[model samples]
Target: MSLRHTLLAAVAAVAMTGLAASAQAKTEITWWHAMGGELGKKVEEIAANFNKSQDQYELKAIYKGNYTETMTAAIAAFRAGQQPDIVQVFEVGTATMMAAKGAVYPVYKLMNDSGLKWDPNAFLPAVVGYYTDTDGNMLSMPFNSSTPVLYYNKDAFEKAGLDPNSPPKTWQELAADSKKIIDSGAATCGFTTGWQSWVQIENFSAWHNIPIGTKSNGFGGLDTQLTINSPLDVRHIGDMAAWQKDGIFKYGGRRSDSAPLFYSGECAMYMNSSGSYAGVKGNAKFAFGVGMLPYYDDVKGAPQNSIIGGATLWVLQGHDKAEYKGVAAFFNYLSSPEVQADWHQFSGYLPITQAAYELTKKQGFYEKNPGTDVAVKQITLNKPTENSKGLRFGNFVQIRDIINEELENIWAGKKSAKQGLDDAVKRGNELLRQFEADNS
Candidate 1:
């Protein structure tokens, strides 16, 4: 009842309120990603949702250009000790990311350190395997994973006197159908592709169960050699060259440069990443259908699983424990079924979890969008063989550039498929050896 005692209690209550507010303040973590357009919006939305959910941390998503540019920037930032808490690296950069000593904080380690009980089994095997180390520990979290698929203009197929409902299931069928489309004037070109090496060499070898390189595609050992220039690979490229001459297949530049051809209605058939679905849906004017990528159909174990093409989230090493905790929490939020399903349905990326796939299936998202599951079915219909799992090699970005050069020579009729690929393998092996020595 004394005025002095009452004043002291009031002041203590006000100070306690201030302390509680300060304790619940969020820790900020930066995430540098390569996503743009609608995908970028989804990333920001996820961050916003997580920031509102628990108030323990806030994830800041920053656009850092495309895959190669993002990786380059990350490396530069790392050298300067200014790297973000997390960086999205493409599948091709897996080896480079792993080889960088003390540059990355493994996802498993971060989760464990933060007391987050993470389950590796929750992710699709083919996806998780790409980011996991030789010891089967996950080095990064798989997000926005995708695989190549066939997209055809149904109107073009009908005009060519082919069954609009049925798509080419084999390479022979696709070639034959493409010819008809061109001959019938259904499109300016029958078929065109983005990233010739990615669709033709990388996923092509995996889908056909052919080795891209020795030693389990370089994951088994550090001293693996380039073996992608095999007889089967040469034969496939030779067939494509012949098709090019016959005006059935058109060659575009690397990556998704050919996407404009398909979107502009110049190409009747396209083989590109499933992640392009969102863009195609917005741009295509005619009725379109999606199908699984065509394979040889006769190769033993043909129709094997296709590897992913998108990127994953890797935590950088120099960040403090508080930042790492925020990174782990953000990853956990991103991996939930609701988030995964919404993303898969929105952007055509494969749902990284069985629960997300099931959620989409139950909600009839696939039924409403008939071809939405084509990528999922193509990647999961068959178990992954050694060849189908994924690729890991140092200086792979340079290796991809070499592949582009050789394939371009073949397309331009300057070299035969066998010769071009042989030269690429030779040049690529030198880089591989150098990388082995440097990282050893």
Candidate 2:
């Protein structure tokens, strides 16, 4: 061959190789999440796995802080035009996210725009309901969804002469058992709970089949009003206040501050998110058991499905098409049965997909771990009522703080339960009005 032809052929081969390398380069998608510790590691693992499985995309998982902190950071970043591609927002923040119309790119829209096959029906009804809009469009991808459950130290139950296997199923039974545990010196206190507004008031109202607020707990409209100061709410809170006074129920600080109380063997019984299973299993020294959240047996339609407590991954707006395509791909990867099931087992969170749940059952995970199914069963036991589906109050973060302040007052004996809750409702309504005015 001629020397000129040979040189030209070699240069063309090198140019083609360079173009292929550039084409194969990955589009990086940033995900800011609230998960920490073991959960955080799982997030990293999921990202790493997705990165390994594909050449077109890379997911970078960043732990911003706790749920509130992570959300705040995302909002700040959005305002600064430096937001991540995705941010995990807790269920309570659903209304706020919905109100920020321009700031978020709905998951349904993102998937559709990216040419990904999306089915809202593939997810558990209750899990998806919380993050969906009134039109039934999914706003975010459900991740690490969980419900509150009763966790008790079996050793404490045995020492207290209660049946370690049969955990309390009703409010009265819980109180009775808690008193016995305290009296018998089985533990320092009877019971404590985390996320007081979530577990105690929100789920508490739903579990009793009562309205947390008018307008289907704000699902109907932004002009919702709080009904949580109703007779039922007052009665339940008063009962808890009485227990606190009797030293039968200890009032641990908000969120998961009470988690240590249970695992440390200081508190015999605790109520928190089912997702805490991994934390308890890894940290608790004593034998422990999980049970359905207790309810007041006297209430009509009691023991309803508990509401979900975890966060969902929301794709933010203003990202490039390539980055969004990467987000869509990563979300699809995360939602697969294999990834979802593993995450469900590893993190003690509910599987977001029906296929994942069924896969876990087929694998005999529930059979091997007796109480691990409590949260799943509790969350899916019955068809969700408007009350049980979940809450959507506006300005929930501030409203939650208001409720917590009143609850602290009740715990401190400075106010009666009725008075505290009534005040919370009144004060919370003003905030709701403000949110409505600000967003409307």
Candidate 3:
């Protein structure tokens, strides 16, 4: 009732009004990504930069474990009606996301609906084609596209009397070089690889220009069947099994567990995603060289282009128009030549747009970084055929698990290469069929 009390109440009301106005000024866009460690920092930096570059939106980046975990979390959130504005899904989960109908906003359509000028043609064909629907519409924004590349320890190569400048181009050469490195006191083992399903099976088939399954590796339609039990595949698996016995190849682990074998210098070489450049550059104590994935010398159309494995940004549904606009603006910012080039240079991910690649080259990034261009060159080495462009199998995460288990069986001498591969194909096909039934 007093004059001083009235003034105090008015001041408190003004303060609350200011707080509400400040919160309403910028729409917050939450992004869920799977980039961890140094890569996670890069994602956060990008979000901060975007937030600072605009007054209309606050881009909040969140790390949600690995690729599989991130995707699983996103889907679960969607089911619970608490999905983030954007989610990063790995290339392997492409089919599952595509099948989710109303859950995704379709990046191309989102950009159009938001009235943001978008040219899908500006992106690299390999990157764009992978995320595009059969109708040629872009499903997700290609954020961190990467392909497999061979990394070898230069010091180990030199100690083993192998040419440090020259990396093995053929499987035969790789086998011989691996033996020389192992037989000598250079390394405990010749080589190890991460993502047995990806590096050993999927990319193996692509680099050799062979199909892992019918219907163009599941790119054509849902009606597909695994053909990983082919003669070439059997021979390659059999060779790896023999190499394991000879101590030329070691099953370091799954996914990226084999990375330490190469980084610790226990293994002379490693085959993994090119996005791992930042990690290897950070961890390896010895000088290293990058090369294309090795292929069998006798196989026709061998050494074809390697496919990508990194994640892409999908625009999730259920956001308001203001939020969608923010997402579009953030996507555009992320796709800019400067942003893309910086990400490609710093994180070793491929620049989704051609302009970014050109900008990187003009900046002499490739020359300064040396073997960094190996992935770009290998990805665009030749025009992509159905078998080499990329794969689009359903339930591929489960398929990859099946493949890893089958591969381990062969490597551990529990099953012959043919038997292991046959069993994998049989088991994987069941999942594929189930996926078709569920999606259809």
Clashes of each: 0, 0, 0
* Tens-digit lDDT string for candidate 3 (97-190): 9888999999999999999888888988877777877677899999998988999999999999999999999989999999898888899898
- C-alpha lDDT values of all predictions: 0.89, 0.91, 0.91
| Quality of model 1 by C-alpha lDDT | 0.89
Clash pairs, candidate 1, are none
TM-score of each: 0.94, 0.93, 0.92
Ranking by TM-score: 1, 2, 3
Best of the two (1, 3) by TM-score: 1
Better of 1 and 3 by lDDT: 3
1-440, model 1: which lDDT tens digit per residue?
A: 89999999999999999999888887889999998877889889988898888777888889999888998999999999999999999988999899886999999989999998788788888878888877888888998889999999999999999999999999999999988888899987878888777889999999999999999899987799888789889999999999999878888678888888888888898999998887788899999999988889778888898888889998899878888888888888899999999988988899999899999999999989989899998889787878988889889989999999999999999999999999999999999999999999
Which 10-residue window of candidate 1 scores lowest in summed lDDT? 126-135
Candidate 2 per-residue lDDT over residues 1-440, each given as its tens digit:
99999999999999999999989887889999999987899899999999999888888999999998999999999999999999999888999999999999999999899898877789998889888877888989999899999999999999999999999999999999988998899987889999999999999988888989988889999999999899999998999999887777898798898888888898999999998887888899999999999999989899888899889999899988999989988889899999999999988899999999999999999999878999988988888888888989889889999999999999998999989999999999999999999998
